[model samples]
Target: MGGGLPSDARTMVVYFDGNYVDANDAKVSVFDHGLLYGDGIFEGIRIYGGNVFRLDEHLARLELSARALMLAIPQSRAELAAAVCETCRRNNLQDGYIRLVVTRGVGDLGLAPWSCANPTTFIIASKISLYPQEFYDNGLSIVTVPTRRIAPDALPPTIKSLNYLNNILAKIEAKQAGALEAIMLNAQGHIAECTADNVFIVHQGEIITPASSSGALKGITRGTIFDVARDIGVPIREADLTRYDVWCSDECFLTGTGAEVIPVVKLDGRVIGSGKPGPITARVLAGFRQRVLVEGTRI
Candidate 1:
């Protein structure tokens, strides 16, 4: 739901299938199974100040996710990495988000991924933001959704598959509940994550998050926050969390490539610390944003 680079920007470069093309010229077949059955895997990457943040980590996760689903990405890891950078350079992108997708190519209307002869690759680099500028400044209010994240045994949270019906259900629930975001629980009644971002909470003086084993995507932004935690000497742990823990938390936040680190000041009508973004969360968010702009392998 975000727009691409400005018109005056250089020709947007996109790597599709096996060739580089103008972003506007990139297209895929309607018969593609990924469009019909959501058979694909994708990663959302961020670039800042002319540098791509966490390029290696995002690529690694992309490969891991693809492997989990037994989908073959036609290009090697190094090739895909260069493709992403080239796409960014083609767009003259100094700061933006990248969506890298590998889909099951056009095939007969079938449910199986194996029916496809060749995997279709599409890369689109653009700018994105989940919330408006005011939300980050004023903090967010969220609601608990009836839709639970799929248990790991059923869909395995490790695979960032394209099937996102579970997430979409939670988003619908959040809209019905009159909140900006939805808090999804796992089948076991433990806090999992939001519709699109990983969750974290501050208790007493330590940072705690629902473990990846508890059915959350191992988010790149989540990993970066962990590094910041360690660098700042804040104790962090992966544990099982419940609605009660979130209700009593001193601070709460959500992380993703698009959402970044956004503080939640209220949950299900309960106010978080001072009903505002907590000191620790603010510091970590600022630190993480700063890192994105100042460092990374330049394109």
Candidate 2:
């Protein structure tokens, strides 16, 4: 589905399949494998102060995910990058989130993707979000969900594909428990990540995050935060982290394109660092924002 114009000046446009469509008119088939079976990959990108932050890194991850699924992108990397910028320009989006997805196109009800010859590519430039400002300022409380991350050997965590039922289920559990976010444990009962964002902790003046091998996404935001921590003289490390470690952390937070850097003051009924945003977390957030505004590349 596609359209050329928007109902209102603020509605803007989106690129769907091979055509430019009004934001409201962009739609995929009911039988598209991406929707039916989560047979696709996607990326979440952020725009800050009119500039797309770490666009190349997001695209690189997108391509890697596509390749991992053997799903060919309809455009080259350079072409796709330009198209993302063009979509943003057409929409007049400056400070918003971009969701780019590639689906296995329409196919039969069967699970086989071979019948779907062409993959569908769509880019929507729109504002997106996560935790409210109050949550960031006052800090959020999270609970450890019973759900465990998918074993890496089974689904390969590097594939940022659309199979998020696991994450959604955990989110539902968190909501039912009256918590802000859910902390997922690995198969072995160690902390993996939140439903979406990567998890990190600060202890003894050092920042530590769980290794991707522990079933977390190789997060671009996490990588940038690491660099920012180093620049600010906050030593960072990546290693296996357990629920006990999180319980005893001096400070805790989660990182993602949408989540940004949010402080978690409590986990599973335990208070983290006097139950407030710690000094190290605040400083790291400041560094991240500074880098995004000054050093980030424009798209």
Candidate 3:
């Protein structure tokens, strides 16, 4: 693996611009609008036991994000899906993460979208682990950062664009404060979401999270948690959340494609209920794991 060749191929292959290529050769241009202007859309999908989990949903979201940004995808849905599966096959991944990106392609040095000729696309399949086992076993530590989410009117969170300086600033705050994750608020001081994940809290036996309107991205894992909660007979809903609510809630957790599901035991400085993963959180995680293996596009 010295020169980007893995002992096994499960993490060293890529699909770039309609061709399968070695990771070392798959490179984007310096002038690509995606790199220069953060003009792009992406999706992080997961594969479980050789099956691509919820590929259709991820593709749908990608399409929606592209439409919102007025970006043209170079490939059709079927073609993109095929490329994803092929990338996984080339990498020989049994279980891994897939990152699909569509960029505005190379453009002039100036800020003109029309200067770009075509869109750039790439698919990468690789291994991912966002947190250590101990964190998942015990719980994660997070803090509320000063950086608020980007206002919906300015740039909707639903677009899933590459412009993530807002969240990155919040992450920097969390890291500086010795926290594993950061919770961001909207302009109204209402909870939006974590820097890299969606937030969920259990209060009085009812599970709740911030509505997407509050500036949180509707994550695939977050939606699956709703399904998981329902299968386990737990009530769930979307509502406004606050720092006080997180501190007082019976339990809390974060969800993402990379993070899967992780329990939260503390926020800011207050210890959450019992300071450990709760019964409901455990059940929902288990249920979500079960669904990952059974529901997917078989690769």
Candidate maximizing lDDT: 3
Candidate order by TM-score, highest to lowest?
3, 2, 1
In order, what lDDT does every prediction score? 0.88, 0.88, 0.93
- List runs of model 2 lying over 4 Å from the truth: 1-10
Model 3 CA deviation exceeding 4 Å by range? 1-11
| TM-score of candidate 1 versus the correct structure, residues matched by position | 0.94
lDDT value, residue 188 of candidate 3: 99
- In candidate 2 the C-alpha lDDT for residue 192 amounts to 81
Q: Which of the two, 1 or 3, has more lDDT?
A: 3
TM-scores of the candidates in the order shown: 0.94, 0.95, 0.96
The collision pairs in model 1 are none
Instruction: Please state every model's RMSD to the true fold in angstroms.
Output: 2.7, 2.8, 2.3
What C-alpha lDDT does candidate 3 achieve relative to the native structure? Answer: 0.93
Please give the RMSD of candidate 2 to the true structure: 2.8
* Runs off by more than 4 Å, candidate 1: 1-11
Which whole-number lDDT from 0 to 100 does residue 133 have in model 3? 96
Any idea what lDDT model 1 has? 0.88
